[model samples]
Target chain A: MEALVASAIGLLTAVGIYMMLRLRTFPVILGLTFLSYGVNLFLFTSGRLTVNAAPIIGRTEPYADPLPQALVLTAIVISFGMTAVLMIMAIGGHLEAGHDKVNMSDTDDDTPEVQS
Target chain B: MLTAAWLVDVAASAVTGDAVTVKITHWHGLEAAALWMSLAAIGGGLMALGAYPRLRALWDATPRPEAKAIFDGIIEPLAAACRRLTDGVHNASFSRAVTVAVLAIAGAGVWAFSGGTHLAGDRALLPVTPTVLALWAVMVIAALALPFYHRDRVVALVLTGVVGLLIAPLFALFSAPDLALTQISVEVVTILLMLLALNFLPKATPVESAPGRRFGDVAVAGIAGAGIGWLAYAMMTRQPAFDPISHFHLAQSKPGAGGTNAVNTIIVDFRGYDTFGEIIVLGIAALVIFALSETLLRSPTVTRRLGAIAPVREDGDRHPMMLVVATRFLLPMAMMVGVYIYLRGHNLPGGGFVAGLVFAIAYLMQYMASGYVWSHARQRYDHHALIGWGVLVSVLAGVGAWAFGLPFLTSGFEYVNLWPLEEFELATAAIFDLGVFLCVLGAVLLALASLSRLGLRTGEDVNTRAFDINPDAAQAEEVR
Candidate 1:
């Protein structure tokens, strides 16, 4: 069961990394979403391969590692924030520079002197 | 109980054996797998059902927007501008609404934090202190920012800077000391630079007109803020899995490397290569700024006195006596505190980050208490030289470590045997600390000086040649 889950994660990671290498903003966003899923699944599966255990420890039951789950939840939110920031910056840059290209090529003459 | 269950499984295993030989079947939990598969199928089926009409109408119904492109291009930017202006004008009432919303959200957040702890069994969710504290801070900041936003633009800008400054503590809370220090210093310098830059811009004004259309701004802001709050709350309920760097810290901290501070140990020893790259990036950034300084300044859009501000005469009056005196008294105290922070950083809550910023504020208060003219006259260092020296010092430290047959940031200590005192470890780590300190102080002042010298529009007209030529040249520049 562990092997299977590991293999699944590996596959997802490979695909996600590949997509991340793409030059376009849209695909990069999609890639990030995919990568996040892979990461969350990988993280969730680290608590040993349990069939019946949900890690939601009740009054009369043994407990699972709840910390990893908590962390994964945070990763989800932070990733969302990052995605939002990335999207906004991308869109704003595209509009201002009049190009949706990933490279900052079009603003050769028009680029604001970015400060240190 | 767990052992009992295992014993029961063993007993069942023995009962099925002829010679006590029991075999677990392959795909034993295949039924559970089937249930999961069915769930996936159901979700896929729902998606297909929803997507079918969209697939059919992809070309026919999804043509470009029916409105004229020109109409949209004109309206969108104008509308966005109008909205921003309207929000700025009606900021007082909007801020009140925000304050209320933030309070309610924070209250709910506290309830959630308590509920999370309560709902947990033996392996209950850990009470995440930082997340809770961060939430509280956000709400507090939101509430506090509103008054300043309504009253004064400078105060609003400072409030924004405070929010950025708070990012350092958040980073520090997460145990990323280097990141925290860098972030705090950068935030301070940037804010100072901003204030100086705004010396050319219009003074902040109260909304003379009736503040209306505020409901739209309030609703939008509330929704956004609420969404963020809930998202952070949901995330706080998650778990921690791994620390990939712990092994390196433990294994290589002593024999492989040398340092008691595990974080600094890792940063200077293991990831020294990354530090080198970052410094290179800093160098490049500085170079870029120098390169673009001319054209960026010369840009047609950067004309002085472009926005018609209510002009003040050259005879600048001092602010109320109490403010000046109060700030004057605070300056020396602040400077001493900054020095203390810088000196005592290695042991306690104080650090180079806070110290450098405290120093900047001390400088800032000098200008505030005294006139800008008086402060400018008392300027000590050549701002350009300070910047160059700071960067050079940081680079030299990195290179110095490299020269010792170690990596770029090889941090270690050599004991100095003095005549009167026992030998002590003068850790090279302190050099990095010093470099950071100098960079922060110098860069901050440089940015302030550069921007403050932009235009003489305020009651801050200098007794310089540019002051005479500027009104006419700047007026012509504004026209063009």
Candidate 2:
């Protein structure tokens, strides 16, 4: 099961990367969303799989790893910030350049490609 | 397993000692187990769906923007008015450097004077507190009065370094060596990055503003830093009552979950969920960086040449062949040490956190020595992919445990005969460690990469800022 979930995450990441390398902005964003999902899933798994147990010992039979859950709550919150920042950047770029092009050299010189 | 103390007492009716009863009878059986399993799956699935990544994105980016906005509005008027008062500092680089130098000196002075800190235990230094207050007062006064008098950039970096370097002592005094090492490394990277950033900004303009206002500003800043610092110092020294977590750690160190390594036990068993969540945060940070890089992060044709940064100091070849060669020599040794630290983390102070940082620093050194061209050429994995892979591996570890009719992140298993070396105990724990390592590595790498790339963009944000700063002036400049 761990292998399955991990493999899924890998597949998502691979897809995300492929999209990330593409020239369009929206697919890149979609790819990022996929990647973040993969990441969160991965971290949640790190506590190692357990069943029928919450982290609160007496709340159930076997206690689950509460720390990972708590950490995940915060992660969810932080990811929202990241998403917003990304969206804002995306919108900002569209506004500036009038096109949602990935690796646009007009504003951000990220591609590092020599300008024509 | 189902019997309580009283029930067991009645059942046996023989022994009468304070034998520890686990109260196993208040038990949740397989049905309850199924419920929790389903719930975790749901939650994990939602995150995987990226249904609400924006929730955290808001929190992390703005840090409670409403409160900040309120504070800023109130402060802005005063700050604007206060700006008229200039600390008579001429050389901006010198002054900034001096500020950093003063802080570094303070760190050194604290160590030199205190001679390795003892747990003060309610011992308050009121007189020296006043001196600290006075120094802070002086800091403000100097900031205000000598606005025109600038010092070296190195001094400013050191001063900034001093502000946070005290954490190293506190970390050491508390016996958290792993944290101490990470903290110090973080500080080094931060200051270096800050210096690198300063390269792109226009040098600080000479202080030619008002004298009375300068005095007022200095006096205010001094009082503020002093008061804040002293208050924090006092609070730390006071030894606050009601430490629930420490008590919890002590109580749980050797019970129910059954792990002797207190930190590991605490993090994985007691609070594994929290660690899980933090790694998720790391994963998110990586995703966000990746996302951000693709769009609003382009640079100009000339700026492409800027990624090959001039080494730390531009004045001379301070990073000589020997140092470069030495870093090359040490790479393998550092990696080995990182592995050692990572492997022994469950039993010792060294763990994924420190080990990850060690490896990262080693990589950074390589980047510094041979430059990004050579270093990046060897990249086998897309940083984005690495981030995702790291997170997935951690989760998959937990999922495996779930499949076994146990709990997530549960540790301490006996070695079963799997070709005679099937230690689920060690393997499961190691997987978690690797997850942490990847998150840390990805996070620091992305942040620094972003910062470095900032220098490469000469006209970055300048287009936006110039347009905003003065539309008329920008339009005039745009014509040229």
TM-scores of chain A in all candidate models: 0.76, 0.79
Q: Candidate 1 regions off by >4 Å?
A: A1-116, B1-155, B158-192, B202-235, B244-247, B250-316, B319-336, B371-373, B417-419, B457-459, B463-480
Candidate 2, residue A93: the lDDT equals 52
- Scanning candidate 1 chain B in windows of ten residues, the lowest lDDT window is B118-127
Candidate 1, residue B29: the lDDT equals 68
Question: Candidate 2: misplaced stretches above 4 Å?
Answer: A1-116, B1-152, B162-166, B203-240, B254-261, B286-319, B415-427, B452-480
Q: Residue B257 error for model 1, in Å? A: 6.7
For each candidate, what is the lDDT? 0.48, 0.50
**Chain B alone vs. reference chain B, TM-score for every model:** 0.53, 0.56
What does the lDDT read for residue B404 in candidate 1?
A: 72
Summarize candidate 1's per-residue lDDT along B1-480 as a digit string, tens digits. Answer: 123555556787788753343344445465778778888999999998899888878867676776679799999999999999876555434234444554576567667766764322223333446553554456355434433253354665555455445544544443334334545554555555445444543344334323343444344334433443333333334332344334444445444444443333443344544434443343334333333333334544443322223345554444444656688788899889888876655433344445656777778766655555557787877655654665676667778866778666667666689979886556665666566556545544544443443333333434422122335777799999
Q: What DockQ class does candidate 2 belong to?
A: incorrect
Structure candidate 1, residue pairs in collision: A67-B239, A67-B240, A68-B239, A68-B240, A69-B238, A69-B239, A70-B238, A70-B239, A71-B238, A71-B239
